[model samples]
Target: MSRWPNLKQLHYLVALAECENFNRAAKACFVSQSTLSTGIQNLEELLGVQLIERDNKSFIMTPIGLEVVQRARQLLSETKDLLEMTASRGGSLSGPLRLGCIPTIAPFLLSPLVTLCGETYPDLDLLLREDTSDNLLKLLEAGELDLLLLALPYDLGSFHSRVVGQDPFRLVLHEKLIDSYEANPARYAGLPDHSLFLLEREHCLTDHALSACQLADQAKINPFAATSLYTLVQMVSHQQGATFLPEMALRAGILERTELVAVAPQGQMPHRDIGLVWRPSSCRVEAFAGLGRLVTSCLR
Candidate 1:
C-alpha cells in the first residue's frame, strides 16, 4: 500500500465534493459509478478517515472531508501548473487551452480571436467559455480555465493581467430620445426616471458603465434590468430606456437594424480597458502575450 493517497483518489474526492452526487460525480470524472464508489472507499481505508456520511438518497462530507477537498483542489491546481511548466519547456503552446471571457466582450471578440488562433497556432486547441466575469474568474482560480479575457480595472486579486485595448462607452438611445435631448439640452440631466437601463447586477459591465459614464443616478431610477446586451437593445428600441454600450458592440453592428442611436457621452468619453489575465504560476505567459497582440489587432 502506498503511504499517501494517490492523485486519482484525490480527484474523485474533489469531484464528489463538487457534484454532491455519486452518479453525477462519476459522470464528471468520466468513470462508472461503481468504480468511483470503490475508489472513494479505498481512499478512506488508506487514509483511515471517514470522509463522508452516506444516506439512501444523498451523502454529506464530514468536516475533515471538506478540509481535505480544499487541500485537494489546491494540490490539483499546483499539479496542473507543474505539468504545464514541464510541457512549456519545449517553448510551444499546444494541447487544450481553456479560455474564458465575459459576456459583454465574448460576442465581439470571440470569433475573431478563434479565427486568428486557428490560423496562427494550428496545434493549439482553444476551448472557449462565455460567462459572467465573476464566474469566469472562479473557473480560472479552480484551474478549469487556463486564461481569461475580461474588462480591466477589476479586482483580479493576485492574478497577472495585460491591457489589450480600450473599449469606449456610447450612449445608446432611441433616435427620438436623441432628438429630444438635442432640442432640450437641459433634459440631459433630468432624463426621466427609469429611462436608463443596464445589465443585471451580476454583470461587471453594469458597474463599469455606471462608474465610467457616471450614470449612477440613472441606475437608481430603474429597478428593472436586462439579462443581455441584445435584450437591452430591444428594450431601448421599444422606447423603454437608454443604455451605455461598449465601443466594440457598436463596431460589431449590434445596433445596425434598429432606430437606436449610439453617441459619445457628454464631456471626456469614458471606457473600459480590455485585458487578458492568468494565474501568476502559469507557464503560458508568452502564449498569452501573443494572444494579447491578436486581441489588440482584432479591436483595431
Candidate 2:
C-alpha cells in the first residue's frame, strides 16, 4: 500500500476538502494545480479508495474522504506540535505563523499589531487571514492557523485562551435621534423592535451588541443589513437608524467627520472581551502565550 499515505498527500487532500476547488487549494498549498491533483491521485491509489468525486462544474468529497480528512488534520497537527516541541529546546520561536481574526476586529485592531509582531520577532513570518469567526475557528481546528483573535463568551468549546482586551458597546445615534434619547436615555433601550440596523448574521458583534443592550429577546433587528462597520456608521450619519458600535471602532474614528456621536448606554455598559486562542494540544503553547501578551501590548 506504498507505506500508506504521506504527510504531503494528506495535506493536499485536506486542503482540497476545505477549499473545494483545485485552483484555490493549489494556491493555498503553494503548488501548481497539477501537483496537488497528482498528490491526491497518488493518495487515492495507495488507499484503494476514491477520495474526491470530480465533476465538470464542482468537486465533492466522498463520505470516507470526509472522515479521512478529519484524521489527516489531527495527524498533521500532532506532527507540527512535535516539531515545535523540538524547536523549543533551542529557545527559538521563529517560523511561518498563520493567524486569523474576524472582520470586525481586523480593521480596527490588526494593523498596528501586525507591525508589532514584525518588529518583536523579525524571524516570524506572520500570515494573517481576515474572516468570520466561524471560518476562523474552522481553520484553527483544521490546524491551518496557529492562533486566532476573537471575542469571547460565545461557544468556543475546549479551546484555551488569554483575555487580551475588552471593547465596550457605544449607543450610536443620529443627530436627530439624540434629542429623542438624551432626555430619556433609557428610552433608547426600548428602540422600536425594527429600527436597529445590524450586520448580517453570524457576525459575533451583531449578537454581542444586541445582547449587551439586553435586546436579544425583543429588539427588532432590521432586515436591511450592512456588510461592514463603515456602512453602519454611514447609515447612522444619514439618520437611517440607531445601532451599537464597539469602543475600538469608535477609537478608530468610525464616526469622525460626521454628525454621528456615541453615548454610553445607561446602567452597566455592554462590552465584549477579546482573546487570543489556540488549541491546547498545540506544541507552540509557549510561543502562543508570549504572543498573547505581546498582542495585548500592541492592542493598547
Candidate 3:
C-alpha cells in the first residue's frame, strides 16, 4: 500500500488551493509560511507528484494538484461529518453548519427561525450567509454552504429541495398614492412601466412580485431599483411609487412607520413558495430536515 500525507498536510494543500498564496494560505491554516511550505513539500514527496507550480510572483495548481485539492476538500468534509456522527452517537449534535439565505426571505424569516433553532437545537453551530439567489445557489453547489433557504419557482434541477411554506405578496402603495391606485385601477394596471418601484433586475423576488401581481405589461417602472425589500419599503415610504412585499415581512414590523397601504391582488392571492435546498449528495440531510421543520413551525 502507498503511504499518504497527514491530514495536516492535506489541510495545507486545500488552503493553498483556496488562497493561491503561500503566506495567505499559511495564515488561514494558522501556521508559519515555512511550516506550510514544508508540509506541502512533504505531501508532494509522499504522493510522488508536484501539486503546485510556484515562483516568487505567483502560485498555480498543477492539474494533478487541482484534483488533489478537490479530493482533499471532500475528504476533509467527510472527516468532519464522521466526527459529527460520532458526536451525534454520543447524544450530541454539535458542529458547524453553513447556511445560505436569500435577501428577500432572510430579514423576515431568519429571526424567528434562528430563535427556534437555538431553543430546539442548542448544540447546532449555525453560520449564516445572506446573499442573492444566484450567489447562494453557487455557494451551495460549491460545497461552501451546507444548505440554502430560498423561494421557489426557482429552477434547481441539480439540487434537492423541500417546500417549507408559502409567503404571499402584498401590494404596498404610498398612503398618498393609494387614492390614485383606488380611483384609477385601470390606469395603474401597467404601472410598473410608470410609477412602480421594483427590486433590481435578476432578483427572483422581482419576478415573483411582478408575476404574482400580473404586472407584466405595466407601465414603465421607476428608474431607481431597490436592492432589498427594506430598501424598497424605504423608497415607497419616501416616494410616490408603489412596491410589493411578502406578508411575513409586512407583518414583521417592516411597515411600522411607513405610510404604506397593503392591498391584496384582485384575483387569487399572489405568493411564492419557500423551500429548503441542499445538494443531493449531502450527508447532513437529517439535520437539514430538522432545520426545515423548525423553520416551518416558527413561520406558521
Candidate 4:
C-alpha cells in the first residue's frame, strides 16, 4: 500500500504558504504551532521531498513548495465542492458562495445583485469581492473565489463562462466638447487624436473599450492614464479629454452631478458583454445560470 498526505496536512501547508509564519498559520488553522509544524513535517516525510527551506534564523517556501501549495489549493477546493455537491443534491443552493467582480462593474451591479440574491435565494450566502479583472481571475483560479461577474471578451483560460447581457459603451465627454463635435461633425471624425482618456492598462475595461471603439492608434490615447472611472470622469469634467463609459454606469447616475453627456457613437453602438464565469468542476452551474438570469433582469 502507498502512503498519501492527508487533507489536514495539505491544509496546513496552504496556510503556512499563505501566512509565511508558523505561529500565524497555526492560529489560522486553529491548531498549536507544534502540531501544524509536525503535520508539515509528516507531509514532507510522506512525500520524500523538502517542501520548505529552513534555517536557524528564518525560512522560505521552496519552489516546489509554492507549486505544491497551488495544487493543494485546487484539491481543497475540489473537496469542498464535492461536499457541497452532496449536501446540495436534494436542496436549493445554500452555502457561502464567494463571488468576485471587476472594479468597473462592481459599483454599478453589486448592490442590485446582492439585493436580488437575497430576495431570490434567501438560503444562499453571497460573499462579494471587488478587484481588477486580473486579480479577480487569479483569485477565482486559486479557488479563493467561487464565481465571477465581469465584462466579457476576457480570456477565462479553461473556465466556463456565459454571457448574460450587453453593456454598451457610450462616448462620454464634457458638454462643451460634444457641442463642438456636433457643430462640426466632420472635423471631429469619430474621436479626435490626443483626446481619449482611458483607465490604466491594467484594467480590462480599457482594453474592452479600445477594442469596441476601434481606437487602435496610440496617438488617439492621452498619455495621462486614469486609475479609475471616477478619475476618468473627473479628468473629462475638467475638459481634459473624451472617454468611453459603460452604459450601466451612466444609468447608475455616474454623471448625475456633472454636466457631462453620454451618447451612442455615430454608427453601431460599441459594447462589452457582461458574463458570469465559474470553474468547470463547479457543481452549481444551474444555480449560477439562474443567477445569470437575475443579472440579465437587473440589466433591464
Candidate 4, residues 1-300, lDDT tens digits: the string is 298789999999999988889989999999999999999999999988899988875689988888999999999988877777777772355778888998899999889988988999888899999898888888887778888998889888999999999998988887767766676555245456778788998889988887887665677678888998988999888854688899999989898788788766543678999999988888878778878888999998
Give the alpha carbon lDDT tens digit for every residue of 1-300 in model 1: 558888999999999999989999999999999999999999999989999999888899999999988888888887897787677663466777889999899998899889998898898889999998889988888888989999988999999999999989988887767766566565456466678888898888888887887654553356778899988899878864678899999989999889888877754778999999999878888877877888999988
Model 4 stretches with alpha carbons more than 4 Å out: 184-192
TM-score of 3: 0.87
- Candidate 3 local Cα displacement, residue 184, angstroms: 4.5
- In candidate 2, residue 144 scores what lDDT? 76
How far off is residue 300 in model 4, in Å? 1.0
lDDT of 2 at 204: 88
Backbone clash pairs for candidate 3 read 190-218, 190-219, 192-219, 192-221, 193-219, 193-220, 193-221, 194-219, 194-220
Answer with 3 or 4, whichever has the higher TM-score: 4
In candidate 4, the residue pairs with backbone N, CA or C atoms under 3 Å apart (3 or more residues apart, or in different chains) clash, namely none
Clash totals for all models, in order? 0, 1, 9, 0
**Model 3 segments more than 4 A misplaced:** 89-94, 184-192
TM-score, structure 1 vs. true: 0.93
In the range 11-38, model 2's lDDT, one tens digit per residue, is: 9998998788999999999999999999
- Residue 290 miss distance in model 3 (angstroms): 2.1
